[model samples]
Target: MQETHDINIIAWWGALLSTFLALVKLWELWNDRFRIDIGYNFTGAPDIGNEIFVRNLSSKPIILSYWELLYGSGKWPFRKLEEIESPGPDACDIRIDPHSSKTFTFAEENYFDWGLKTLKGRKIYMRLYVAGRRPVVKKLYG
Candidate 1:
């Protein structure tokens, strides 16, 4: 009778652990379901600077707080500017609705002001982030 009780207790513990693990996995899935998706477009290279457009293709709203531009060669990377360095506003907080888009006008003059040389024939990279979200980076070679 004691052996049967011990087996029952062990089985109960095992079932409880399994249930807890399943709950944790479900929570992770729920969090991921709400995360936003960003889509990048290399519009064109007009002479001033590269034109790039960013859009939120996810089904949820995203709050864009900050973004950075990186220009470099080989393996060495350098940061060009942030939203603070640009014109639109000092605070980079912009809310994007689902399937909506926003255009950012980045000029070569801004890069020169940041002490970076002309982006002609150079590889330019971009890294943008939404508030309380991960950073998305993209590279464009012209």
Candidate 2:
């Protein structure tokens, strides 16, 4: 009887350890998934011509301060680190909450006109920089 009780105890401990390990792995997976997801949409308007709509689809918030738009003309968004590291907010830098979206209205300004002219009949791409995350380089194709 004593030997059977020892076996039962060992089996119980083995199952408990397995369950704890599984829980730890699940927690790690959940933590790994904690990051911002970004998206974009283009809307045409009679006045603005085109609106660049940005969306944050993740469970976390995103700071646009690290964002830089590389025009198809090979224009540099910032020349140096000091320029890129925005200490304060700019027109482009805004905080986006989770599952929220931002719209740049009146995008038909000179910048948009230039963008259209430059991107005409060509592919589009973007360079994204977020703090504590790897740079996301993606090609934008419609």
Candidate 3:
């Protein structure tokens, strides 16, 4: 009789453990995973600085793979000003924590030769490629 009771208790514990593990897996599957958002930061005063904000709204961390900014002429037959390419591989690869935001400042110093004065009062378009996701594009005033 004791042996039968011992077997029954072992089986009961085994079933309970399996159920707990299954619930944990289900909970993980239900949450969002690997997603991010990108947008431009407008401070109204252009001379101060221009920046782009990227928010990681996912359960797991992510890396920024590539990005580019194309200045728009804001009119018919729009022309594209100097394109901003991603920095070096080490610099371009940014590790963003889950549910966090990061800001990337524009390289304003290089604009002297490229006519930063003319590029002002125009629209700028930015494209970003995050890890394991489709490319994202956004428009902002330069």
What order do you get sorting by TM-score, best first? 2, 3, 1
**lDDT tens string, model 1, 72-125?**
455436534323233344765888887777777655555322222455445566
Better of 1 and 3 by lDDT: 3
lDDT of 1 at 113: 27
Instruction: Candidate 3: list runs displaced more than 4 Å.
Output: 1-34, 43-47, 72-82, 88-90, 107-122
Task: Evaluate residue 62 in candidate 1 and report its C-alpha lDDT on the 0 to 100 scale.
Answer: 83
Best by lDDT: 3
Worst ten in a row by lDDT for model 1: 79-88
Candidate 2: residue pairs that collide: none
Q: Counting only residues 3 or more apart in sequence or on different chains, how many pairs clash (N, Cα, C under 3 Å) in candidate 1?
A: 0
Tens-place lDDT per residue, model 3, 20-46, is 999999888777756556676544343
Indicate the worst ten consecutive residues by lDDT in candidate 2: 79-88
| Model 1 spans > 4 angstroms off | 1-50, 76-89, 107-121
